[model samples]
Target: MRKATFIIPAIVIVMAIIMSSVFIVDERQRALVLRFGDIRSEIEEPGLNFRIPIIEQIVLYDSRIQSLDTAPIEVTPSDDRRLVVDAFARYRIIDTRQFRLAVGNGGLREADRLLEDILNPQIRAVLGADGVTSNTILSSDRAELMQRITAQARVLAEPLGLDVLDVRLKQTALPLQNLEATFARMRAEREREATDERARGEEAAQRVRAQADRTVVELVSDSAREAEIIRGEADAERNRIFAEAFGQDPDFFEFYRSMTAYERALTGENSSMVLSPDSAFFDFFAQPGGRAPAAVPAPVE
Candidate 1:
């Protein structure tokens, strides 16, 4: 009975001791063993671990890709405009020894501190010195800019034994008031340009219309003058033809003219006048050139 009691107690104590010294190393986890508040060893693989129960301390970290989000920072551009900028990065520990010496605070709080002290100033310098805009956080040269920033970050992280793989800009925006003012200015400029273009078009249209109207009036006047000249020439030609035809028939033309004159002067409505034998009218009846004969013509025998 005495031996049985001692054995049971010993087993219980052994179980408790084993439980205290035992730890789990998951596939995705890496651990740093610290003794006397300093890195004593590193476990880069996943398996079971044994330690001095109260003397050694272990710190675990995810060996997979990890991310860090930085706080929003205000950056001034070459144009003297201020923009609020925020960003993040992805990184992993490539060397376990370096990681143990390099890692400090593993959360966003530490990232914020690093951003405030080192990253923000570098970002401003690069962004300001760029041949581009002062607000050039992310741009066509974003990759190059980020590369420069990563180099600087790597230097800062060297003491902590961390490597900065990449940095990315999440968002960039101006102050609300500045944004509103920018929009207003853009709208006004566009509207003014459109108005000027429209005025120019109208002026061009007016010029075209004036030219057309002037041409129309000139064409009409020219046409009317040409038609009048043609008509006058035609009348003149008819008169010339009539004069030529008249020269070919002198006796008939005279007789016709005298008959026309008689028709005009002696109308049926007016009474006829009797003239003396020696009258001027009788002369033309007797002989040509208005001469009357000395004696009347005798009747035919």
Candidate 2:
């Protein structure tokens, strides 16, 4: 009974030790074996691993690409205009041993802090370079600026065992202090454009109205000239007909003209004419039977 008890307990203890000595490094992880809190060996390939039980410790780190978002930072370009820029970075750990040595137990957190510290200056340096204006930073050329920033930050990040794959500006905007000023300037420009367009429209309207008025004036003047010509032609035709009638009968024509004058002069209420009874004007009234007056011969030319 005692042998059986001792053997069973011994077997259980050995199994526990074996289990403690063996560790599995996942495919997505890189591991470091530590002895006495100092790094001894790095396991980059994913597979079964072994460590001395109760003496060696293992640390695992993700080897995949990671992302870091930076806080919005203020930048002043060469144009002296202030802008707020938000940026992000994509990076990966190429050397796990160097990363573990550099960051120790703080691991990725400490590395992140250092990365941010490196990024800030690089961002400011590349974005604030001489002759780099705010317009360029906000434009598509910002991609070029980011490339330069990534290149510069990569150099600084090498010491941290971090390979910076890319750095990009996510948002670029004017500071609050300059926003109102920019809006005012834009509004003024739009207003000036509107005014110019309105002036052009008014000028065109004036030209159209002037042309219409000229057309109407020309039409009315032509009509008036034509009417005057028609009236003059009708008057000449009537005078010619009267001349023919007078040549045919001289006395009768004189008598007829005298009667027409008398009818016109005697018309209307209270019409009066002061003349002698033997006056030639009464010749028509004196002859009731239409008696002819003495024939007057034509005058010599």
Candidate 3:
């Protein structure tokens, strides 16, 4: 009974020691074995791993790609325009030993801080460089600027065992204080453009109206000239007809002319005229055949 108790206790102690010394490294993880605060081994492959019990410690780190979102940072471009930039980075822990050495016990949290430090300066340097205006940052050219930032950040972060795979600008915007002023300037510019367009339209309309007015005047003058020509021609035709008729029959022509003259002279409802009955105006009236009366032999003087 005494031997059995000792054997069971020995087996239990051995099992406990084996459990503490053995660990499983997941496929997505990298493991480090440390002894007396010094790294003794790095386990990259996933599977069973062993460490000295009670004297060695194991630290596991995720080996997958990770993302870090930086705080909004303000930068001034070459043009002195201030902008707020929000950025993010995709990274992976490439060297677990180097990462642990750099960040100590703080692990991923400290690494993230170091990464931000590296990223912010590169962002500022590339975005605020000469000729890199706020307009450039807000345009498609911003992609190139992000690439520059990523290249620079990769260089700086390599020492921290971080591989900065990609960096991107999440949002780029004018400062809150400048937004209203910018909007006002844009509104003013649009208003000026609108006014110019309206003025051009009015000028075009004036030119069209002037052309139409000139056309109307020319048409009226042409019509008046044609009417005058027609009237003159008609008068000449009438005079020729009258002359021909008179040549054909003087007595009849005289009678017709006398009738027309009387019709014109006696016009209104209350028309009155005073003339001697013996006047030549009554020649047609005195002779039924429209012949003038033979002059009576003048009294012997």
In terms of lDDT, the best-performing candidate is 3
Candidate 3: regions farther than 4 A off: 1-4, 261-275, 279-286, 292-301
The global C-alpha lDDT for each of the candidates, from Candidate 1 onward, is: 0.71, 0.88, 0.90
lDDT of 1 at 112: 40
lDDT (10s digit) by residue, model 2, range 112-181: 8889999988999988999899999988898999999999999988888899999998889999989999
Task: Candidate 1: list runs displaced more than 4 Å.
Answer: 95-112, 134-139, 237-301
Top TM-score hit: 3
Per-model clash counts, in order, read 4, 0, 0
lDDT of 1 by residue, 148-225 (tens): 877887777665445677777788888777898989999999999999999999999999999999999999999999
- The collision pairs in model 3 are none
- Candidate 3: 10-residue stretch with minimal lDDT: 292-301
User: After best superposition, candidate 1 residue 174: deviation in angstroms?
Assistant: 1.7
Residues 1-301, candidate 3, lDDT per residue (tens digit)? 9999999999999999999999999999999999998999999999998889989999999999999999999999999989999899999999999999999999889998999999999999999999999899999999999999999999999989999999999999999999999999999999999999999999999999999999999999999999999999998998899789989997777777667766777899988889877766657667766576532221221
User: What TM-score, to 2 decimals, does candidate 2 have?
Assistant: 0.81
